[model samples]
Target: MKPSLLVLTSLPDDNRERIAASFDILYAPTHEARAKSIAKHGATIRAVLTNGTTGLSASEVDRLPALELVSALGAGYENIATDHARTRGIVLTNGAGANDDCVADHAFALLLAVVRDVPQRDRATRDGIWRDALPLRPSVSGKRLGVIGLGRIGEKVARRAAGFDIDVAYHNRKPRDGVTLRYFDNLRDLARWSDYLVVATPGGAGTHHLIDAHVLEALGPTGFLVNVSRGSVVDTDALAHALKSGAIAGAGLDVYESEPHPPQALLHLNNIVLTPHVAGTSPEANAACVDTFIENATRHFAGEDVLTPI
Candidate 1:
């Protein structure tokens, strides 16, 4: 018999069907259903499939005594009880590189949309307004683009920026190997120097509100900010104030503090572009993520080294 798996995410129908064919899946995409499923079938569950946002908690993990492997369907796993799982000798894996291209594509889409005022211009055109009536926006080409995290997604963003003749620099906890791009030890310095600041860092306590009032100020009146990272990284209030006061030129965000609810403070702002947290949701990316999970689970069950361990 196949090992029983508890799936906590709401997968696409095709992905769900694929997983069902491989494992005895206990689908629980809602909180009440999750609790009930755990209560009824926890002992039989040998693995869990979750994502970064809908993490598996320590308390939940404890109930599943048979769980040996936990897989995050996407790159981030900030909410997962990683330390607790490690202590219990449970294996953890994530879809680290699976969705990088999709996310990078979205990040560039946001950056271009806001910088060029694409959304606003489209609205103006539809409302019988002419190009002469609309205020001019800055050119994105030949500008300095600063990346907050130089990981897989960040590197891809930098690569895209290059196509527009933009110079790239980054601020990571430490510099990555084999990269010639300029590195900034201080995030504020990077912000001050950049024409556009793009955040692609990991989410968690350490990076909570990392881009706050001071960083926004450093980006100054002419700069723009783009966040494809976690919402917690940027303070919503600060960003709103900056946009309202013209402290920064504009912003483009894929993730925000409010999450399922839109950022109330930024809703009325005309200088910002917002998208639901969908930086990595493409058909190709989703397929790659699920494939990565299956590979990790297969390797772990066969006593082989799991790929993309977190």
Candidate 2:
């Protein structure tokens, strides 16, 4: 018999079919469905597939006595009860580098869109507004770019910046080994030094609102901020105020504090660009994510070391 695998995310039909070919899928993408599926099939479920946002909780983990693995289909596992799962001897894995290039691509798209005022320009051009009527936007090239986290995605962002002749520096809890890019132990210092700040850090309490009012002030009137990381890392209220008051020139965010719904405060602002948390999503990325999950789950069931253990 195929191993029972509980799925908690909503996937496209093709992706769903791909996974279902390998396991007996529970297919609970909604909240009520999740609860009902767990209650009814708890004992048979040997693994649970979830993403960063829709995490598996401790109570749910406890209910599934047969669960041997919990896999996050993306790099983030912030909401997953990792510690609790650890205590229960459940293996955890995430899609760490599966979408790194895609995320880096989106980050650059946001950066260029905001810095060049692409959205506003498109609107103005459609309105028959001449080029002279628009205010001058800053050049993205030859600027100091600060990256908040220098993980795989962050490194890719830096690489993209290089194509534009941008200078790159980054901040992490500790400096990454064997990188020639300048490193800052302090985040505020990185913000102060940068013309554009791009956040690629992980979410959770340690990095909650890592970019706040003080950091914004340090970024000052001419700087730009971009967040392709978790929304909690950048305070929406603070960003809204900054954009309104011109504390910073503009911002580009792929993630925000309140998700699924747009950030109400930032909606009316023209100096910001927002994408619906799709930094790591693409047809290619999605396929890679699904493939990574299958590989990890398969290896774990075979008593082999799974790739990308979280």
lDDT (10s digit) by residue, model 2, range 257-285: 88888999999999999999999999999
Q: Candidate 1: give its CA RMSD in angstroms.
A: 0.8
lDDT of 1 by residue, 1-310 (tens): 9989999988899998888778999889999999999999998999999988889999999999998999999999999999999989999999999999999999999999999999889998899999888778889999999999999999999999999999999999999899999999999999999999999999989999999999999999999999998999999999999999999999999999988799999999888999999999999999999999999998998999998999
**Overall lDDT per candidate, in order of appearance:** 0.95, 0.94
Q: Which parts of model 2 are misplaced by more than 4 Å?
A: none
Q: Candidate 1 at 108: error in angstroms? A: 0.3
Clashes of 1: 0
Q: How many residue pairs clash in each candidate?
A: 0, 0
- The list of candidate 1 runs beyond 4 A from truth reads none
